[model samples]
Target: MDSEKAVPGDGVVVRAIRAGEWGQARRLRLEALRDPVAELAFLESYEAAAAKPDAHWREWTAGAAEGTRDRQQFIAETAGGEWVGSVTVLLERAGTVDPFGGTVACDQGHVVGVFVGPAYRGDGAGVTRALFDAALEWAWAADVERVRLYVHERNTRAEAFYRKAGFVASGVRATGPAGVGGFELEYEMKRSA
Candidate 1:
């Protein structure tokens, strides 16, 4: 599902990222890492992400881009062609281990790497909403039992948005993705019966 939001003059469209757009993916990720709340919003630090080589980006982007079996990244870009935001969904098969070493009790989509450029944040958060809409649609299409995301304890703003997007707390707490002291609360949208 492609969504259009009134951000730029001509508006922005949300769609799955492509493999050849690795450069845009890398640059957009760096931009996201620079956001003020990025420390709590993302798992990796700016320095760590920026230090990755072009090859790392190419391979990573390729894996997360459309055509991959396990993941898909949906990005929002203006009609003028500037990327505004992105949200990626990763499929975790039941009986497998997740990135955090937790057992995946069921097939699910784990949403991550959510971001909207500063210019397109807040009142213009339509970009973010559109991004999530696309990401969630993709997850549901993949027939996951549910879609979940982890948010930092102190990141109230992000948690609010996730709630608004229909995800509710799962009563599970785990170490933040960075392996830091803070806890990351799990939020999920279980598939309707």
Candidate 2:
């Protein structure tokens, strides 16, 4: 698969994660889990992620970073070679069950693990946008009908950005386990044929 495409501005380039870069991916994920909004932005806790074995991390990266048709992870890197953000997309097919235990009813892409570091968030940075663009581009190229993501109802920052990026609330609501404040809303953006 072709990788390493440059974003239009700010010298941030979006690229596919390669095999053997599991350590880097793990570090970035742990960093994302440390963000102030991490509790709402991600389902996994920093402690949980930190406790995972190296083999687990490697397998995780290998599955998404290997350019498999089922999923892909894209990262935004600066000119100085720092990874600032990431977004991952998983392609679901009809008849296949999703991580959420829902039966896949159509060919679609589920966007997940989206994040941009504190230093990279702001006007004109474009790290998050670039990462999303790359993932959506991959989804469209694969002919998926739509891309969908679930955002914690309290995470207004992510909701607004997703709306600005053309995603609309699909009226799908999910409640997490009883102790977690239980409310996430699904948003989706469809591909134009």
Candidate 3:
């Protein structure tokens, strides 16, 4: 399905991720994870993400796009069809436990793995805003009451962007594993009536 949003720059398209775009997704993901600030945003290392098998990529992309019972992924592509950014929203089920240690409430959606290529960043192409809009629309369509994302405490740029997109900090902090030595800041955006 093509859900287009008005981005600041010309010829930008925001839509659901394609089914067989695993190769492209994998490539873009690696590029994003290689960014200087990646350590604060993404959990997987470039080595780990790059080493995944084709089957893994296929499953990851497919599951992320169409979404399973739990997760969904979306992409923002330029008019020329280059992927400029991406976002994934994971649904937390009621009565079920989450890996982040919160009992699921109101079928919340957790946004993660958000990244925009450096060339596209700060250009106000609307890639980041478009991605968030699309993800929240999907979550609300799926009957989720609210959407949330965890930003690393050090990732001020991402926090600023999220704030611009109408997300407010819930004042919740979660610590990463010892080696990472960072705290995650949780931000949430609620579905509008």
Give per-model CA RMSD: 2.2, 1.5, 1.9
Q: Between candidates 2 and 3, which one is better according to lDDT?
A: 2
- TM-score of every prediction relative to native: 0.92, 0.94, 0.91
- lDDT string, candidate 1, 1-193, tens digits: 4433343443777788888899999999999999988888888989999999999999988998876778999888887889889899999999999888889999999999999887777744577777877788888888899999999999999999889888999999888665556899999999999
- Residue lDDT tens for model 2, 1-193: 3588776767888898987889989999999999988888888899999999999988888988856788999998889989889999999887899777889888999999999988778657777787888899999888888899999988999999999889999998888534568688999998886
lDDT values, one for every candidate: 0.86, 0.87, 0.82
Question: By the TM-score metric, which is better: model 2 or model 3?
Answer: 2
Each model's total of backbone clashes? 0, 0, 1
Candidate 2 has an lDDT of: 0.87
- Looking at candidate 3, the ten consecutive residues that score lowest on lDDT are 1-10
lDDT at position 96, candidate 2: 95
Task: Sort all candidates by lDDT, best to worst.
Answer: 2, 1, 3
> Tens digits of per-residue lDDT for model 3 on 1-193?
3456656655777777766899999988998899998888998899999889999999888887754556778887787888888898888877788767777777788898999887767735667877888888778878987888898888999999989889999988889645678798989987778
Clashing pairs in 3: 64-73
For model 3, what is the error of residue 123's alpha carbon versus the real structure, in angstroms, after optimal superposition?
A: 6.4
Pairs of residues clashing in candidate 2? none
**Top candidate by lDDT:** 2
